[model samples]
Target chain A: MENKILNKLKNSLDYLSGESISSDLNISRSAIWKHIKSLKNKGYIIEGKSNKGYKLISCPDILSAQELIPLLKTNNLIKDIKHFYELSSTNHSAKELARGEINNGTLIIAEKQLCGKGRFDREWISPSSGIWFSLILKPNLPPMEASKVTQIAAAAIYKSLLEFDIKVNIKWPNDIYLNGKKICGILTEMKCDMDRIHYLILGVGINVNLEIDDIPDEIKDIATSLKIELNKSFKRSDILVKFLNHFEILYNKFVLQKDISEVLSICRENSNIINKKAKLITYNKEEIVTCLSLTDTGELLVKDSDGKEKLITSGEISFRI
Target chain B: MENKILNKLKNSLDYLSGESISSDLNISRSAIWKHIKSLKNKGYIIEGKSNKGYKLISCPDILSAQELIPLLKTNNLIKDIKHFYELSSTNHSAKELARGEINNGTLIIAEKQLCGKGRFDREWISPSSGIWFSLILKPNLPPMEASKVTQIAAAAIYKSLLEFDIKVNIKWPNDIYLNGKKICGILTEMKCDMDRIHYLILGVGINVNLEIDDIPDEIKDIATSLKIELNKSFKRSDILVKFLNHFEILYNKFVLQKDISEVLSICRENSNIINKKAKLITYNKEEIVTCLSLTDTGELLVKDSDGKEKLITSGEISFRI
Candidate 1:
C-alpha cells in the first residue's frame, strides 16, 4: 500500500496533494499523509505544503532495487529485479534463480547481506549503505572464457565512477582501488560445463556512501567508502544506473562483437599496478613479479624474477603503491 | 517398509521362515510374503520351499541406491546418498545440494529421470535400465583446472570396464564407445570463481542394461548399451560400486597428489581419436584437423591442415572410423 502511494507520488512529481492521492489510490487522506511521512523518513524528499501536496525532490541513499530498476537503462538485463531487505547472499540467491529458467540480466539486489561473499567464498563487509547486487548473465560463450567477466566488470565500474568525476584504479582482475585502498569488489561465479556456460552470477559490491563508522574494525584500515573519501554522500541508484549502462555496452562488445579491446584499454588506462612489482599467489605458491600488461584473453602477463614471462590466468595478486 | 525387508533379507542370507520374520520384525506374515513376492518379480532370486521361508540367491539388474550403498567402499564421497525413484536430472539435484553447505562427496542417484540433461543442456534419454547418477565433489583446486575432472571420469570408467573383461574405447574427452557406438557419457559442471573451485557435480550416465526396445529410434544409430553389445544384462549395482571406487582413487590422486599421469595414460592408451582425423567445430567455425596428443593441462593438441599446431581448449570434434 505504501509502495503504491510512493509510486503515485513519484509518478506525479509536479504536484500531488493528500486529497488527490487518497482518491487516486482509494485510501484516506490520513493514510496518504502517513505513507508520505514514512517515505520521507526512509530518505525520500517530499516537499509537502498547504496547497502543493508532495513533490519528490531527491531520493535517499538506499540500494532499493524497486527504485533502481526504473533508473537502469540496460537492455535485456535486470528485467525482473528481486529486491530484498536482507539476504544471506545475492550470489547464492542468483544461483538458485539460475537453476530455474531465469533470463539473462535478471538482477538480485539486497539492501543488507548478512553473509555477503567475495571470491573463493571470502567474507565481504556489505553494510546497509553499500550497493550489493548480483546479475545473472547467460553469455553464449564457453566456460573457459567466463573469467573475462571480471575485466568487463572493472571496465564498467571504472567508467561509471569516471562519469561521477571520481577516478579509481582497477587492481588487476576484480578489485577496484581508490587512493591505494579497496573501494569495490567483483566476484564472478559460473555454473557451466567444459564447453558451454549455463549462467554466470556477477556479484558486485561497491562501497558507495558507507560512512567510516559503518565499516568493521578489522577492515577499517583497508576498506574505504566513497562517502568517507569524499566526505559527502551520493545516491546509490545513480551509481547502479550508470554501472548497468556501461556494463551492457561493454558486455555486448564482448559477447556479440567478440571484442575485448575496449575493456582492456580501460583497464590499461586506469591501472595503477601496471609496470610495478606485485606479489602473485596461486594455490599456495607465491612469487613476486613485475606487472606487465593485460593479455588479449584477459590474463595478467607479468615478468617473474627469473626474467621469464608468465601468464597469470587465475590467482591473487597484491599490489603496493 | 520394503527397504527394511530387503535389508533384513540381505542380512540374513540363510533361510528364514515367514513366521520367524513376522515375529522378528513385528509385522504380519502376509505382509512379508507380499513384499518378498514383489522383490522376486522385480528380479531378485529367492528360494522358497514348503517348510523353509525364503533364501536369497543373487541380486538383479535393478539400479537401487540402497542396494549399492552397502557395496560402496568410498570414504568421504557418498556417506549421505539421496535416492530418487525419478528426478528431472540428478545433476540439477546435485547442484541444488551444492548450493547449501552440502558436504563433499554427497551423491544423488535416480532410478529414472523424467528430464535428464547432458552437456550444453541437451536432452538425454534416460530409460529405467540406465544408470543415471550425479556426485558432488569439493576438490581443492582452481576452476581453470576443472576440465581435468572429465579425464578423471573417463579413466575411472575405462578401468572399471576393463575389470569386467569388456574392452571399450574412450572417445576423446568423456564418451565411452563400445563397438564404435557411444555406451556412456559424462557431464561435469562446476560452481566457482576464477581462482578457486567451490564444488563440482560429476554426472555419469551409463547405458548398462538398456534393452533394444528401450532405446530411442533417433539415437539408436549412434548409441548402444552393455546388454545390447554383450548379449546379456550386467548388474547396475556392480558397475556403480566399481565406478565409485575407481573415481575416488583417481580423484584423490588428481587432487591430493596432483598427479594426472594415470588419467592421461588411460586417456591416451584407449583414445581412438588421438591419432585420427576429426572435424573440430567452434562457435561459428569448423576445421578438419589431425589429432596429435593430449597436453599436460588436459587440452587437445591438434595440427591443422596448414601445418599449424593449435591447442584446442573447448570445442566439439567429430571423428570418423
Candidate 2:
C-alpha cells in the first residue's frame, strides 16, 4: 500500500491528495497517513500542504526491493529481488537460501558486504559505493557445462556497460576490465552431483561508484571503479537492471535452446586477452602464452612459447599489459 | 570413560570385582556402578553378583559412536564417527556439517534413515536393518574429477565384500550387485567453485541384514540383502568396519597420490556389466551396447550398435538379462 502511494506520487508531477490516495488504493484516509509516515521514516522525502496534498521529493539511493522491482524488465527469470542494507556476503546468503527449494533467478543484493569474496576465496573489497550481488540460478545443465554460466555473465556485463558509452573489456574466464584495470569479477559456484547440478550461485561484484579513498592502497593501482574513470556517479539500479535484462536473455538462450552463439560473440567482441600475450597461472606452473580465441564451449584457446596450442579450461590469466 | 569400562568388560570372561575395577580405572566404586548402569541402559546386558563386579552378557546391534569408533582402524581418514539411531538422511546431516570448517574425515552414520534418498532424488527405503552413512571428504581436487570418488568407493565395497567370501559385482557408477540383485548404492555429492571443490559427501546405503519382509514390495524383485542372499544375519559393525578400512586406504591413494589405478583395477575385476550387453540410459535416449573395459580415468568404455566406441561418463546402465 505504501509502495502504491509512493509510486503514484512519483509518477505525478502535481500533488496527490490523501482522499484521492485512499480512494485509489481502497484504504482509509488515516491508513494512507500511517503508510506515508512509514515511507518518510524509510528516507523517502515528501512534501505536503493543506490543499496541495503530497508530492514525492526524492527517494534515497538504496537497493530496496520496492525501488528495484519497478525497474526490472524480467519475468520469471527474476521472480523477486531481495535487497539488504548490509550482509556478510551475498553469495553466502544466497547459498543458504539455495539449499531450500527456492525459485530460480532469485536475486540477493546488498548495499555493503563485510566479508565479500571472489573466485578461490580471494578478498573482494565490497565497499558501500559498489554493487555486490548474487543471483541464484537452477539451470537444467550438467556439472561439466557449469562453466558456461561465467561466460554468459561476462557477456551480460560487457553488453550492459556498452549502453553507458563506457568501453569495457572482459578478461578471459570471468573478470571485467576497463582500460586495463579490473572493474568487475564474477564468481560462479555450485552444488552438484555426478550428473546434475543442484544449484549455482552467480556472485558478481562490480566496482561502480567508489571514490579513490574507498579503495585500499594495496589494490588501488589494479582496481578501478566507474566513478574513477568517468568522473560521474551512476544509479546502481540502472546498471543492475541492464545487466539483469541481458543476463536473462543470454541465460534463456543457453539453457532453453542450448545456444551460446550470441554470448560467445559478445565475449569475443570485448575480450582483452585474445590474440595477446598473457601469463597462464596454474597451481603447479606459470607460463607465457598468446591467447587465441574462445572455443565453442567457452574455453580459452592459447598457444604456448613453443607454439603448441592448448585449450585452457580452469586457471587464471594475467594480461601482460 | 563408559567405553573404557565396556571394553574391559567385553574383553574379560569372568566377572570383575568392584574393588579391582575401581583400582584399575582409578574411579570411585559408585562412579563405576553409575557408568555400568548407563551402559546397561544402552542395551548392553550385564550380569552382576554380590561379590563380582560386572560381566557383559551381550550387546545390542547398534552403530553407536562408542561401538563403531573402537572397531575402526583408521588414522586421519576417519577423524570421528557420529552414529545416530535415526536421521532424516546421513548425507543431509553431513552436508550441513561440511559447510563449516569441519574436519575432512568427519563421518555421519545412522542405523535408520526416515527420509533416505538415492541419485536424482530417488527414494531409498532405509529400514533399521540397513547401514546408512555419509563420509565427509575434503579432497584437493577439481569439480570435474569428483566422479572418481564414486569409483573409489565402489572398489572399496567390492574388495571388502570379497574378503567375506561374498562374490559381489559392481554395476557401473556406484551400485553393488550380488547374484544379479542390487545390494548397495553410493551417492557422491559435492559443493565446488569452477576450479576447486570445497567438500564432498560420500553417502553409502547398504542392504546388510534386512529380511524379506523389510524390503519394499515395489522393489523386492530387484533388491536383495545379505540375509536373503546368504540365508544368515551378518553383523553390521563388521561390514561397516571393513568398508571404512578399505575406503580409507583407497581414498588416501586417490587423494594424496592422484592415482586411481588401484581402484580402477578392483572395479574392473568385479564389474558384471563389462563384456555384457546392457542398456545405456541417458536423459534423452537409451540404447543397447556392449560394455567394454574401464578406462584409465574410471569412465565406462562401451561400443554401440554401430560399432562406435564411446566413453560413458554420467548415466545409468541397465543390464540386459
Candidate 3:
C-alpha cells in the first residue's frame, strides 16, 4: 500500500488529494496518511498539505529496486533489479546468480562493497557514496567476441556522461577518464566453453559522490571522483538510469543486428589512447608503441618503435598522460 | 592395515608364513588374518593356506584410489586421486572442486555416471564398464590457449591405447576412434577471465570394457569398446594408469616448458581428418573442406571449396566415414 501511494505521488504533476488516493488504491484516508509518514521516514520527501494530500518532491539517492526499476527505459536488457545495502562485490553475487536459471539483464547493485575487484583481480575501492553494480548478460555470441562487451560498456558510460555536459574520454579497453584522471572502471568477467559464452558479468564502478578524503592515499593522486571534478554532488541513480538506457540501445545493435558502428563512432571520437604513445604489455613481452586506431571489431592497432604495425586483442596498455 | 597387507602381498614373489607377516608388521596373527579377510570381501583374490600366509592373486577391476594411486607414476600432475562409487558426472564434481583450494592434478573418478555429458552438453552413456573421469588443471596460460588442452587429452588417450597394441586415430579437437567407430570423447570446460584462466576441467570418457549389449540402442552402431574389439576384457585400472602417465608428460610440457611439439607430433601422425574431405561446421555455417595438417599450436589447417586456406579452431568437423 505504501508503494502504491508512492507510485501515485510519483506519477502526479501537482499535489494529490488524500480522498482521491484512498479511492484510487481502495484504502482508507488514515491508511494513506500512515503510509505517507512511513515514506518520509524512509528518506522520501513528501509534502503533505491539509487539502493537497501529498506531493513527492524527491527520491533518496539509493539504487534500490523501487527507485531504479520505475526509472529504467529498457525492454529486455533489464528484466529485474536487486539492490543490497552492502555486499562483498556485485560481480561475485552476479556470478552466483548466473550459475542457476536466470534471465538476461538481471541487475545487482550494492551500496558498498567490502571486497570489490577490478580487472586482473585488482583492488577496487567502493564506498557507500559510489555507484557499484553488475549486470548479467547472456549474449548469443562466441567467446572470442566476448571482449566487445567491455568496449560497449565504455562507450555507454562515455555517452551517458556526455548527456550531463561532462566530457570524459575512454581508455583502450574499459576505463573512463575525466581531466586525465580515472573516473570510472569496468570489469567484464565471463564463463564460457571453446565456442560459446555461458554468461557474462559486466561490473561497473563509478566514483560519484566520494570526497577527496574517501580515496586511499595510494591511488588518490591518480583517481578523481565526479563530486571532485564537477565541484558538486550528483544523484547516482540519475547516472545509472541514463547509462542503462544508452547501454540497451548500443547492446541491442551489437547483439541483435550484429552492428557496432554507433558504438565505434562514439568510442573513436572519445578515445584517449588513440594516436598516443603507450606501453604495451602482453604475456612476458613489453614494448613502446603508438596506438593507431581501433579496428572494426574493437582491437587496438598499434605501430611499434620498429615501425611494425600489429593488431592487439588482449593486453595491458598504459598511456603516459 | 588392509592396504598395507595388500601392498606386502603384491610385493612378494612367493608364499610366506603367517608368523613372518605378523612379526614384520608387529601385529598379531589374528589381526593380520582379519585384514586379509576384509580385503577378500572387497573383491580381492587371495590365496591362503593354514601354514603359508595369504598371497594377492589379482586385484578387483575397480578404479578406486586404493588401486589407482599405487599404480600411477606422476610427480605433480596426480597429486590426489578420488574415486566415487557413482556421480551425476565427473566434470560436475571437478568443477565444484575447482572452485576451492584444489591442487593442479587432483583427479575425480566415478565408477559410473548417472548423467554424463559430452561436448556441447550432449548426453554420454557412461556405465560401470567405462572409464569416466575429470582432471583439474591450473595452467599458467592465457584463455586463447585453452583448446590445446583438449588436443593434448586426445593425444594422451591415443598414446595410451597404442600401448595395448590397438591403433586408434585421433579425430581433430578431442575424439579417439578405433576401426572407424567412436571409442572415446573429451570435454574441456573452464573458468576464466578475459586475460587469464583460473582452472580447467578436462573430462574424458573411454569405452573400455563394455559389451555390445551395454550400449544404448540409439548409439550402439557408432560406439565400440575395447572388450568388443578384442573379444576380451582389459583391466580398466591398467588403461587408466597408462592414460594418467601420458597425460602428465604432455600437460607438463605444455605448461612448464611452453612446448607442445610432442603432442602435435602424436596428433599429426594419428590424425583421422587430415587430408580427408569433411563437413566443417562453425556457428551455423557448414562447408566441405579438405583438412591439410595440424598447426604447431594444435589448430586444424584446412582448405575450403574456394581453395582458401584457413586455420580452424573450436568447431565440429565430421567425416563421412
Candidate 4:
C-alpha cells in the first residue's frame, strides 16, 4: 500500500493533490498524507503547499528493502532482502540465516558494520555510505569448485561498475581496485561437508560514497571510494540493485547453463598481471613466479622462478600494488 | 567432581563399603549413595547389598565422558567433552559449539543421532548401539589442505581398531570396511574463509554392536557391525578414547611437526586396493579405473582402462563390496 503511494509520487513530475492520490487508489486522504509524511521522514524531499499538494524532489541514498526489492531484476534471487541499519557483520548474519530453511540469494545488508570482516579474518571498516551486504548462496556444488563463486561475484561487481565511467580492476581472488586503489572487497565463506558445499556467504563491501575523513589513516592511501573518484556521491541503492541484476544473470548462467565463460572473461579483462612478476605462496612455500593464465576452475597458473609451471590453488599472490 | 567418585568405584575391584567410600571421598553416606544411583541410571549395573554396599557388576556399551575422559592420554584434547543422550547429529552440535569461545579439541558425542548425516548430505543411520561423535579441530592451515584432516582421521581410526583384531580396510576418501562391508564412515565438515580453515568438525560414525534386526533392509548387505562379525559387544568408551589419543598424536604431528608421514603410512597400510577394478567418479565424470595408490593429500591415484594414470580428488570410487 505504501509502495503505491511511493510509486505514484515517484512517477509524478508535477504536484499530486491529496484528493487525486486518494481517489485514484480509493484510500483515505489522511492515509495518503500519513504515507507522504513517512516518505518525507525517510529523506524523500517533498514539496507541499495547500494548492499544489506534494511533489518528490529527491530520494536519499538509503539501501532499504522497500526500495531495492521492487527494482531488482532477479526472480528467484534476492526477492527476500533483509536490511539492517547497523550490524556486526552481514556475513555473520548471513551464516546464521543460511543455517535455517532460508532460500538461496537471500541478501543481508547493513548500513554500518561495527565489526566488518575481511579476508583471513582481517577487519573491514564498513561505515555508512559504503555498500555492506552478504548474499547467501546455496550452490550445492563440489567443494573444490566453490572458488568459482568468488570469481562469479567478482565479475558481477565488475560488470555493475561498468555502467559508471569508473575504471575497475579485479585483483586475483577477490579484491577490486579503482584508479589503482582498493575500492571493494569480497570475502567468501562456506559451510560444507567433505563432498559438497552446503552454502556460501559472499560478503561484499563496496566503498561507494564514503568521505575521505571517515576512512582510517592506516589505509587512507590504499582505500578509495566512488565519490572520491567521481567527485560526487552515488546512490548506494542503485549500485546494489545493479550488482544484484548482474549477479543474478551470472549466477543463473553458472547454475543452469553450466557456463562460466563470462565470469572468466570479465576476470581476464581485469587480470592484467599476466607475464608480470609476483610472489606466489602456497602451503608453506613462497616463491617468485610469473603469472601465466587462469585455469578453467579459477586457479592461477604461474611459472616459478625456475621456469617450472605450477597450477596454484588456494594461495596468496602478492604483486606490486 | 563426578569423575572422582566414578574413578573410585572403577578402582574398586570387588565392592567398596558405603562407609569406606564416603570416608575416602570425604562425603556423607547419602552423597555417596546419590552418586552411585546416578551411575546406575546411566546403564552401570551397581549391585547394592546390605553389607557389600555397592558393586559395579557390569557397564553398558555407552560412550560416557566420565569413563573416557579419565582414560584419554591426549594432553589438551578431549578434556572438554560433551556427552549427549541423543542428538540430530554430533557434527551439527559440534559446529554450534565451535561458534562459541570453546577451545579446539572439544568433543561432542551422542549415544544416538536422530538424523545422522553422511557425505553429500546422505542419510546415515545412527542407532543407539552405534558410536557417534564429532571432534572440533581449529587447525590454522590453508583451506585446500583441510582434506588431509580426513586422511589423518581415517588413519587414526584404523590404528585405534588394531587392538580388536578386525580386518579393516579404509576406502579412499572416507569409509571403513570390515570384511567387505561398511563398518565406519567419516564426514569432515569445515567453517572456513577462502584462505584458512577456521574450524573443522571431524564426524566419526561407527556401527559397533548393531544387531542384524536393527539394520535397515536397504543397507543390510552393505552394512555390518562389530557384533555381527565378532559376535560380541565392544565398549564404545574404549574405542572413543583410543581414537582421540591417536587423533591428538597425528594432529600434533601435522600441525606442530609439519609432518604427515604417520597419517599417510597408516592410510597406506589399510589402502591395499591396488590393481583392483573400480569406477572413479570425479566432477560427474565416471570412468572404469584400477586403484593404484594414494596421494600425499589423500587423493586417490587410479589407472584408467586406457592405461592412463590420473589423480582422483574429491570423487567417489565404488568397487565391489
Q: Model 2: clashing residue pairs?
A: none
Instruction: After the best TM-score superposition of candidate 2, give how far the Cα of residue B191 lies from its true spot, in angstroms.
Output: 1.9
Two-chain complex of model 4, DockQ on C-alpha atoms against the true structure: 0.70
User: What RMSD does each model have against the real structure?
Assistant: 3.6, 2.6, 2.9, 2.6
TM-score of each: 0.88, 0.93, 0.91, 0.93
Candidate 1 lDDT score relative to the true structure: 0.85
lDDT of 4: 0.84
Among incorrect, acceptable, medium and high, the docking class of model 3 is medium
**Ordered list by TM-score, greatest first:** 2, 4, 3, 1
Off by over 4 Å in 1: A1-14, A17-38, A50-52, A69-71, A287-290, A303-308, A319-321, B1-14, B17-42, B48-50, B304-307, B319-321
> Compared with the true structure, what per-residue lDDT tens digits does model 2 show for residues B1-321?
888888899889999888888899899999998998998888899988977678889998888888888888977888878888899999999988888788888889998999999987999989999899999998877787889999999988887888889989889888999888999999999999987889999999999999999888988888899899999998888888889999889888887778789999888888888999989986446899999989998889999999999998788898643
Give the alpha carbon lDDT tens digit for every residue of B4-96 in model 4.
777777888988888887888789988887888888889888888888877877866677777776678988766478889999999989988
Error of 1 at B49 (Å): 4.2
Tens-digit lDDT track of model 3 for A21-128: 988899998888899898887789999899667899998898988888888888888988889989999999998888888888899999999999987788999999
Fnat of candidate 3, please?
0.58
Candidate DockQ scores, in order: 0.67, 0.63, 0.62, 0.70
lDDT, candidate 1, B8-86, per-residue tens: 7788958888888888888998898898898888778988876888888887766666587788898766767787879
Which candidate, 1 or 2, has the higher lDDT? 2
Q: Where's the lowest-lDDT run of ten residues in candidate 2 chain A?
A: A312-321
TM-score of chain A of 4: 0.91
